[model samples]
Target: MNRFYDIINKIENNNNEITVSEYFHRCIAQAINENEKELVDWFCKIKNDVEGELVAWAEKHGQKYILGRNRAERKTWGIQVLLGKKIKYKDTVLNIYFPTEFHENSIIVEQCF
Candidate 1:
C-alpha cells in the first residue's frame, strides 16, 4: 500500500489525538517529497473544501469556534498546510491537531505515492 494510505489506515485504527497528527504529518511530508506541485495544488484545494465543510457544520450545530483561513503554501518545493492549528513534522512522524471539539474527524488525503 502507499505510505499515505498506510498512515491514514493507522490513524483510523488508533483514533487518538497524537497518532492522528503524527500520521498526517508523515503523509504530508512524503507527499511533499514525492510530488511537490501536485500535492501542493491538491492540498490547497482540499484545505479550502475542508474549511467550508467545517464552517457549514459548525454553523448548523451552533458551534462557537471559528474557521480561520486555511492555506497550503509551498516553500522550497515543500508544501505546508496551515490551518488555525499547528502541525509539527519530524523524520518519522507527522503531528496534527484537529480543530473540532465535538467528534473525531477523518481526512482523506489523496496524492500520488
Candidate 2:
C-alpha cells in the first residue's frame, strides 16, 4: 500500500477523529521521504484550519460557491467544493476561501481538482 493509504488506514483504525493538520502531517511524514523538518514547515505554511473558515464563508455566501487558491501553482491545494456545493470559479460575485499563504520556497499547493 502507498504511504498515504497507510496513514489513512491508521487513522481509520484509530476510530478517533483527527484534525486536518494531523492527517496532513501523517501523510507527509509517511510519503515524502525527505527532510522531515522542511516538509513539516512547508505543510504548516500552506495548510489551513478550514472548518471555521468554510462555515463562515458558507454562511455568508449562501453555501453555493467555489473555494480556490489565488496562486496559480497552489490551485490544486485549494478546494473546489464544500458540503457538496460546487464552487464557482471566475465568478467575481462568489466568495472564495483559501488556505494560509506561504513563502515561495516553504510550500507548494497541489491542485485539488
Candidate 3:
C-alpha cells in the first residue's frame, strides 16, 4: 500500500486502458520503492523491444502512429484509426495499433519504456 499503487490506480481509473508510458513509469517507481528496480527495468526494456516491432510494422502500413493523452487526442491527429489492435511484448500489452508512417504531426507515441 504505497503512493505508487495509488498513482497507478488513478491512471487506470482515469482511462479505460493505460498507455505504455503510464504503465512503464508507474511500475518503475513502484519497483524502486519495493527494491526491485532491476526487475522493473528489465520488464520495461522488453516491452519497448516488443513495441519496436510494432513501430516498424506501422511504418510499413502508411498509417501514421500518434500517441496521445486520450483517445480524443489520437482522433485530433487523424490517427484514431490506429486503435484496438493490441500488441503484446512479452508480458506488456500495448492497447493500440502501430502505424507504418510518420509526418510532422503524425504520431504522438507514449515514451516510457
Candidate 4:
C-alpha cells in the first residue's frame, strides 16, 4: 500500500493554516529525526528547492519572512520563529510570532510541526 500521505496536507492541520515551505521545513526536521529515507527521496522528486516554495507562500499571504531574530527577541534568548505581522495589544505591541487559536479563553499554539 502507498502509505505515504501528502506532506503538505499532513502539516496543515484543520485548525492551523500552514504554508508549503513551512510544511516542508517541518517534514525535513521530522524526517531527519526518524531517518525516513523514503520520505526524503520522495520530497526530492517534488520540490527542487525550498526557496521558491517559501517565496511563493509569502506572496500568497502578502507577508515577508526573515531568518534572524526579531527586534523584541534580540536582547533575549534569541529564539527563532516564523515572525508574522506585528500586532498591538492594550498594554504593548508585539509581533505575531506564529498563528494561534482560541481555546476557551486560553491560547493554543498552532505548531509548525
Candidate 5:
C-alpha cells in the first residue's frame, strides 16, 4: 500500500477527532509529496476557509481566538476562556452553572467548533 494511504487509514481508524487545520495540513503534505500542486492548493484554500469559520464563531461570542503553537510547532485554533466562567455541563444528576462574566487562563479548542 502507498504510504499516503497508510497514513490516512491510520487517521480514519483513530477514535479521536482531528482539528480542521491538522486534517488539511496532512492532506497538503501528502499532495506535496505526490507532486500534486492542484491538490495542495485546494487543501490550503479550504483549510483557511474552515478555520476562518471557527475564528468568526469565537469572535461572535466575544471570545478571543488564537492559533497556539504546540510542541511540534504546529498551529492549533482555540478560544481563551476563564476557569471560573459560565459553562453548561450536566452531570448525572443535574446541570452546573458558573458566573457568566469573569476572566481566566484556559484555552478551549472544542468551544470554537
Candidate 6:
C-alpha cells in the first residue's frame, strides 16, 4: 500500500480514539522525527501543487498575484498574494497568506524532529 494511504487508513481506523487533526499531527510528527524522506517529499510535493493551484486560480480570474516563500515568526512556506485593489472571492478577501497553518506547523514540526 502507498504510505500515504497507509497513513490515512491508520488515521481513519483510530478516528474514534482521536480527532483527525490529532492523528494527522501525530503521523507527521513521527514521520519527521524518523526522517521519513518519502513521506516528507510527498508532503512537499503536495504543498507545491496546492500553491500552484492557487496561483493558477488567481491568474484565471484576472488577478495579479505573486508566488513565493515567506518566513514569519520563524516558519516558512510558499505564499501567494493577490495584489492591487482588494479583491473579494465570495465572502473572503484574497489578500491573505495561503496555507498558513499547514506550512507553518510543518516548519514548527521540523524543529522537534
Q: Using TM-score as the measure, which candidate wins?
A: 5
> 61 in model 2: Cα distance from truth in Å?
3.3
12-98: candidate 1 lDDT, tens digit per residue: 322122222333354556567667555445445545654555466446645445344222332232233333333432221112222
> Residue 29, candidate 5: how far off, in angstroms?
0.6
TM-scores for all candidates?
0.38, 0.30, 0.43, 0.33, 0.46, 0.34
Instruction: Quote the lDDT for 72 in model 4.
Output: 23
Q: Tell me the spans in candidate 3 whose CA falls farther than 4 Å from its real position.
A: 1-13, 67-113
**For residues 10-103, what per-residue lDDT tens digits would candidate 6 score against the true structure?**
4332312332223335556656765877776655554454455546655665544423321111012322222322223122112223234345
Q: lDDT for each of the candidates?
A: 0.38, 0.36, 0.40, 0.35, 0.40, 0.37
Candidate order by decreasing TM-score: 5, 3, 1, 6, 4, 2
Cα error of candidate 2 at position 108, Å: 9.4
Displacement of the residue 63 alpha carbon in candidate 3, Å: 2.6
Clashing pairs in 3: 58-99, 58-100, 59-100, 65-107, 66-107, 66-108, 67-108
Q: Candidate 1: which stretches are off by over 4 Å?
A: 1-15, 18-27, 66-113
lDDT of 3 at 95: 33
Model 3 vs. true fold: TM: 0.43
Across residues 14-84, which tens digit of lDDT does each residue of candidate 2 receive? Answer: 22223334445565664455455554554444445343454455566664432332211112333222233
Give me candidate 1's TM-score against the actual structure.
Answer: 0.38
For residues 1-113, could you state the per-residue lDDT of candidate 5 as single tens digits?
24333334333312223344565577687778778776567557755765665565546655453222111112222212222112332111111121122423222233323
Pick the winner on lDDT between candidates 3 and 6: 3
Candidate 2 deviant stretches above 4 angstroms: 1-26, 31-35, 49-53, 62-82, 85-113
Candidate 5 global Cα RMSD: 14.3
Which ten residues in a row are the worst by lDDT in model 5? Answer: 90-99
Model 6 earns a TM-score of 0.34
Q: What is the lDDT of candidate 4?
A: 0.35
Please give the TM-score that candidate 5 achieves against the real structure: 0.46
Candidate 3: tens digits of C-alpha lDDT, residues 63-111: 3552322221122122121233233222221333232234431233442
